[model samples]
Target: MNDGPGGPGDQAAYDVVVVGAGVVGTAIARELAHHDLRIAVLDAAADVGDGTSKANTAILHTGFDATPGTLESRLVRRGYDLLEGYAAATGIPVEPLGALLVAWDDEQLAALPKLKAKAEANGYDRTRVIGADEVYRREPRLGPGALGALHVPGESIICPWTTTLAFATEAVRAGVDLRLSTRVGEVVAGDGDRPHEIRTSRGVVRARYVVNAAGLWSDELDRRFGHRGFTVTPRRGELIVFDKLARPL
Candidate 1:
């Protein structure tokens, strides 16, 4: 794994270390390129995007209703705008297929207006309630119990594969050292005041700063740093993708 330019015990130094090569991690690495810093992005997989990043529904989130003013909301909104422009710059595909939140019964139907109001509160004012006739017209194959639906026009599908790859490729081309499969096993302090030394399966690696974006393994990494700030409950979702010819929506 570490058999690249530097062999075992080479103990090379990097200005910054960004863990994980998911879309978010790669973007951080790319953003660091503006500074004259030696950055290294690490991943446990043999290739990038082989984790939860590869799976799940491929929706480009609008982050509407993300509590409006928190870090999550801010980053998601910024990432949405950034990725939108990036998709245009590159050739990544995105289909603006609006979503229809169906209401199957009277109780569910009563929730439509509230959902629309919530969307408005979330700075997404495009959502509105559609009558049954229009709902049936839009989705001809909808189940018989649907009374109405809330139309969210900003929802869209995206190609997450290219999104992650684009950030990784650009970061690598911009001189970010991408260390693959070099799993960090332990951390050793350097000279009682120097950068933290990461002991990996390959050898010792040093970094002045570290950004932990380990996703599911975030807990394990926090323990390695002697600080259990948070723990993770990894949940995996399974989606069955019908063939493109199956239907177009």
Candidate 2:
């Protein structure tokens, strides 16, 4: 809690409690600070970005491949613009390197036009179906039997580490109570006209509202509060990493 004027409460009762300190979690906390509310962001790790947020493919989604008019599409598009600007301002490493949907067969080569249409449907007009000659010219290191591809030039790579850290740090600097290694195991709702009591290893936390952002284990927290509408279904996307010099064959 910041001692600055109009800061969050310095007492035990927080106006809002947010679990998890990942990129998404910290962003929520940061946005909530614009309002007159006491927000506490908690993380189980020793520090923020120690979770899955620190890993995975560092590619920034252009919302080009995303389904049109979907929630993820809108957020990813807005988030792309938001992060691109934020990354520039905060010195977060980001390279807007274009990607080629490499094709090695006739079927995939035929997919280029359809994929281009899909990109147009998603509000991305820059995507185009390039010829095999242009494809090879763009990615000279591509493997043999390669055909044409759908070029999405907006895709970029970003530093996921700095992105999460930046959000968490900014939110902390903006008057958020960031608690590290503090895990809430149980939540006992107070009776009518009383604050909710959350039991953690350190002590009990009494808060007016609570948000569960605990990536994989968010559902468990929701169960304690007798709220069943929310369920956490983990979705895993696995990919193989490669250095710039490593070419597929």
Candidate 3:
């Protein structure tokens, strides 16, 4: 990946340039590497897995509760299968620990059937309603007066950092250029038979096609291209990683 402090002449021209080295960008880079094309991945961080990807919880959402027949639901389902298979092939650890949506009140209890129906409509039919006895039988140390739970056995977790690393590694191994710490400042579209110019912190990069996968800054980049359909607002979340000994508790 020509990460040297050399000028644009030292950097090889690319057919496609992906702005972001996060999981999504890396995955896109890897997939494009299969084609016979010059590809480059640029990111603002010093290394991959920085930004929101590093802080991800690694949970593989099953979309069991997602609205049925929607684009998001379909994409989630397809992406889940692709990721699951990729993880298995690449030795990325995935834990299918499953999940239980517990109900402590009557209103929540009455929602289990609807949730299960939604799951069914989304083409996931393994969800089931388990009574409180079964809930306590599975999780014996629960508070009193619990009603029921929706057991979704497809929920799983994976190593988010490893997944991103794996994708970046494969993409690099396949000859995709990776340029970290190169934040894109401006994007100039290309004309017919000409290349697009990406103005970055390091230098200008020329590419035939540009992909905006910059995550949080994607909207800002879109604005540079005269499109403003969405905006990104950062949100904070707290994560607690428990040791193996805490699993029993």
- Each prediction's TM-score against the native? 0.91, 0.88, 0.94
Tell me which of candidates 1 and 3 scores higher on lDDT.
Answer: 3
Candidate that beats the other on lDDT, 2 or 3, i.e. the better one:
3
Top-lDDT candidate index: 3
Score candidate 2 by TM-score against the native.
Answer: 0.88
- lDDT against the true structure, per candidate, is 0.81, 0.82, 0.89
Better of 1 and 2 by lDDT: 2
State candidate 1's TM-score: 0.91
RMSD each, Å:
2.3, 4.1, 1.7
Q: In angstroms, how far off is 55's CA in candidate 2?
A: 1.1
Candidate 3 local distance difference test against the native: 0.89
Pairs in steric clash, model 1:
none
**Model 3 agreement with the true structure over 1-249: per-residue lDDT tens digits:** 474657653355789999999999999999999999999999989999897898877889888988999998998888889999999998999999888999999999999999999999988899999999999998898778889999999999999999999999999999998998788887777777889888887788889988888999999988876789899997877889899998876
Identify the superior model by TM-score, candidate 1 or candidate 2.
Answer: 1
Misplaced by over 4 Å in model 2 are: 1-11, 190-192, 235-238, 243-249
**Residue by residue across 1-249, what tens digits does model 2's lDDT show?**
434323343336888889889888898998898888888887879889788898868899898888888998888889888989989999999988888897789999888888888888887899988888998888787777877788889999999998898898888888888887778878888766788888765566678888778877888887888878787777878778778686453
**Winner by TM-score:** 3
